[model samples]
Target chain A: MILDSIQRVLSTNELVTAFLFVGTLVWLSYLISARLTRGQVHGSAIAIALGLVLAWYGGLVTGGNRGLADISFFAGVGTLGGAMFRDFAIVATAFGADIKALKQAGFVGAVSIVIGVFVSFLIGGIVAISFGYTDPIAVTTIGAGAATYIVGPVTGTALGAGSDVIALSVAAGLTKSVLVMIGTPFIAPKIGLNNPHSALIYGGLMGTTSGVAGGLAATDPKLVPYGAMTATFYTGVGCLLAPSVLYLGVRALL
Target chain B: MVIYGVALLSFCMLTGVLVGDLLGEVMGVQSNVGGVGIAMLLLLVLSNLDSRKLKLTPITEKGIGFWSAMYIPIVVAMAARQNVFSALSGGWMAIVAGVAAVAASFALIPVLARFGKGEHQ
Candidate 1:
């Protein structure tokens, strides 16, 4: 009777249950990060990879557009994973920072964000055209994806790009995340990525929050927040530019 | 005290969304642009000010910290929503585009590092 009541409660309060589910997943991911990767790969990156796999599997099982949220038990994940909460988390991360430390990054950090978005978009756009994706929307979406996964989808959705193109953008962003996660430590010493200023600039340039956070964690745990803060800003800047200024530029070029 | 933090966060969030929507309209895009970013800026500015004048209590700080720590798990939830299979099947172009972008970005880090030197003090 107690078990039945517990089950009933969980099913009814789906949002709380979803939180529990995601919490468990994050816990498991951290365990894997600790044991398997020995913390070279950050837990956030692992959690992301695992989430993607689970999403893929959930789709196969349910054949739904909402990914894992299609399952009734996971239904509340739709809201939890939606833009509202995503924004909330992003904002909270900024709240966790010390601004006095941020100002220390100064002009270089600011410049890096603009340069980072532009360079990534330029490279992504060129590659897309080389691949024969001439549609301005496709090129722009893919290029934005290079900026970050969030930027890609946000740009794609804003521009009303096709699903296939959007999917490609997501894939591209994911690849970038994995790369940064694996590559940060290897390159840290050579680039002088030791200080808070460099980390802030690095975050702006790299722009993938999970990637930069994971990479920085492996490099120096103290630097994760600095990198993550700028990375979050990078996402915002990319979203602001990709669909508007960048799209116009790509259209003109094509 | 915790309720105050929640109220402050909510206030920032709502205002951020409004501004983002306006930005989208100005830019000719149909979606909210950078609302989360704006919200973060607001929270940062507000909390910084709070530290100086209002001095939020530890309990409120704890509330904000609780939400802040949710960053990783929330992002995991966000990750779950992405359709990786469709993207993988979309084409090798996706892989190429992504790898190339990151590779180029990685290469430029040292060069970018050069411009910001001497400011670290």
Candidate 2:
């Protein structure tokens, strides 16, 4: 009787339940990571890792594209994680930044974005070529993902690329960002990631806003704004350059 | 006053979307162009307008702070759900590129550090 009632409840409001399910998993992941890793890893990173694992398992079980969402009760995971909330959160980040501090990064920060984008693009393009994805759109989509996850979809959507390719681009970007998030704290001292300017340059070269933000938050909460500032600019510049100049250049090459 | 602050935040977002729409039309792209970026720029500018004139309070700033940070965890979880599954199903290229990008960036750090040539201490 109790199980039947619970099933009915889940059936009626599955999406909210999915949010609750995700929230619990994320909370649990954070707790484990904090205890096990002594906070060497960000809870967000750990939660993301757990999320991916669960998603893979969900797909393996159901043999469906939507992962856990392939199961009825968990269908809300798809909507909860969809583009609607994604854009809402992206725009929400606007109010959190300080403009004055961004200028502190100066010329080095400015130059870093250009170099970072090119280098990441080149690396991603080369990797795509090796994978036998010879199409210009495929290469460019993945290359833009190397620039930033946000840039990947924006470029892919604009260019009318395949959903699978766009998804691949997003994954590629996510992997880069997660690694940066986990690796930044360990590498900080060795790379001289102390001052606001260095933080800015770090953000520029790294070019993943959330990674830089979470990583800086762990390393030194004071530097979050500085690093995030240039990282924010990196995404904007990446978006601007990728579709036009970068795509045209890739087309020229191929 | 805090409610007014959120209202102002929404206003900034609306204006940003409009501007992004215009830019998209100009650029001949089907998608929105930099709405989030423009909104953030507006917010940065609006933050300076907190004054005795607007009757700004700590509460107003706190409200903005509260909601702004709320997005990060959700965004991370969302990305994990979307990206990982896609990368897995889309073949090994995404994973390979992701690993390669991370590796290449790490390799470039020493070079960037040398070229940057800034003081560690």
Candidate 3:
């Protein structure tokens, strides 16, 4: 009976590697941060490291399958990359010594995010229909990821699309990271969104939205805690609903 | 300086992903390898960060903004998958979800803040 239970446990572990992968990476990141930096390393750096390791192991364990490894590798890297760039942009704005300007930039950023979400969803929906793919999970995962450029993996997971979700998530994250890295600094100044407070608002919203998406996409109730923790720590609560809004908006049109 | 930071971070992140993928392909170690790699990198980066003077004031507000922008897409993607909008047969469901999340944050953040302050006190 004990052997049977152990077998069951091992099977369960193999079946649900997602949670394990994420959890292990996070824990490892913390351990590294604490041990190497004496706890001074930035959380973003830890996240980046965790992502890289996950991608590497994900590939090797999956048996030299590039496609298989790509999902986790991309998701982890894209997420860390996005966060890092966003943080850098905000830090730059904060160093500019202009509170009023920052506030304006923040408001503009908030508005732009709202618009970006809407537009991305529209495009994603069209892609789903055009491809003749009706797998709700795939459609939603790919569509959402392609549109908003974040939280695609979580949505993919919730939809039961497996590693593909991670792949889509990575794709979306890359898009957003690239855009924000290139666009925010140049546009914020013109639009007066360069103040530190504004950067805070923008960053908070982004973090919150990612958290909410992750929570909604979670299949296991246990993941909810991790999702919430990620949401709260990585993103602000304000952006949590962004995923749902975009999803439904597109679904409605369809 | 910010651009440089962004570039460096991006490069490190990209390198981490590529290395993780390569290692996984060669050894079949899986995502666990990526996790391990990240742990190693964090240890190295942290060691470097520890020697620098850490300042929270100017970066705090900016940090908040940066996180907010980055997170927006993530939430939007989640909502899209929830099909809450599809089940409800309207866009209002999405709006409701979004509002609820925001409301929950407002309710929860202050409590968290208080708890954090209490710890210090």
Tens digits of per-residue lDDT for model 1 on A1-254?
99889878877998998899999998998999899989877776677667767777777778775667777778777778776776665566666577777776667887888999998888888888998889999999999998888889999998999988888888788777756755777788878888877787788888987677556655665676567666766877788889999999888888
- Give the residue spans of candidate 2 off by over 4 A: A11-19, A62-71, A75-98, A106-110, A131-142, A148-199, A206-244, A247-254, B106-121
CA shift of A132, model 1, Å = 3.4
DockQ of each: 0.51, 0.42, 0.03
Candidate 2: the clashing residue pairs are none
TM-score for the first chain in candidate 2 comes to: 0.67
Candidate 2 or 1, higher DockQ: 1
* Tens digit of per-residue lDDT, candidate 2, span A1-254: 99989988986897778668877877887798789988777676666566657766667777775556676777777766655554455555556555655554456667887777778888888898888888899899999998788889988998999998888888788777766766776787777777666776777777876667556654665566556555656776777788889999989999
Q: TM-score of every model? A: 0.79, 0.75, 0.33
For residue A154, model 3's alpha carbon misses the true position, in angstroms, by 2.3
Q: What is the lDDT of residue B110 in candidate 1?
A: 75
DockQ of 1: 0.51
Find the 10 residues in a row with the least total lDDT in model 1 chain A: A213-222
* lDDT per residue (tens digit) for residues A130-190 in model 3: 6565655566665555433334555555446667444644454433332332233223333
